[model samples]
Target: MAAKKSEYTCIKDNTIQNISRKTAELEARADYKDKRIDEINHNMEIMNNKLDQVLNSFNDLKLQSTSDDKELELRLKAIETKLAAQEKTTEDNKARSDRIIAIVSVILAALTFYFNYMH
Candidate 1:
C-alpha cells in the first residue's frame, strides 16, 4: 500500500503541473492578442490624421488655382479691348486721309483748266 500511494502522488503532481502550464500559455496568448489589437487601433488613428491634413492641403490648392484663373481671364479681356480700340483708331485715320487726297485732286484739276482756257 505505501508503494502504490507514492506512485499515485507522483502522477497527480505531474498532471497538476501540465494543467497549470497550459492555462498560463492560453492567458499569455490572450494578452498578446489584446496588445496587438491596441497597436493596430493606434496606427489607424495616426493614418486618419495624416489623410485629413492632405485633404485640407488639396482644398487650399484648388482655391488658389481658381483665383488665379479668374485673374488671368480679366487680364486677357483687358488686352482684347485695347486691341479693338487701336484697330478702330487706325480705320478712322485711313478714312480721313482719303478725304484729304480727294479734295486736293479737285483743286489741282480746276487750276489746270482755268489757266489753259481763260488765262
Candidate 2:
C-alpha cells in the first residue's frame, strides 16, 4: 500500500510540472505574436503616410499640366490668326497686280490707235 501511494504522488507531480511548462510556452508564443502584430501595424501606418504624399504631389502636377495646356492653346490660336492675316495680304496683292496689268494694256491700245490715225 505504501509503494502504491508514492507512485501516485510522483505521477501527479509530473503532470503538474508538464502543465506549468506548457502554459509558460503558450504565454511566450502569445507575446511574440503580439510584438509582430505591432511591428506590422507600424509599417502599415508609414506606408499610408507615403501614399498620401504621393497623391498630393500628383495633384500638383495635374494642375500644372492643365495650365500648360491652356497656354499652348492660346499660342496656337495666335499663330492661326497671324497666318490668316498673311493669307489675306497675299490675296490683296494679287488683285492689285491684276488691275495694274489691265490698265497698262488699255493705255497701250490707245497709243497704237492714235499713231495709226496720225500716220
lDDT of 1 by residue, 1-119 (tens): 46555343464887899999999999999999999999999999999999999999999999999999999999999999999999999999999989989888888888888898879
After superposition, the stretches of candidate 1 with alpha carbons farther than 4 Å from their true spots are 1-16, 101-119
| Per-prediction TM-score to the true structure, in the order listed | 0.66, 0.73
Clashing pairs in 2: none
Model 1 lDDT, residue 36, Cα: 99
Candidate achieving the largest TM-score = 2
Clashes of 1: 0
RMSD of 2: 4.2
* lDDT tens digits by residue: candidate 2, 63-87: 9999999999999999999999999
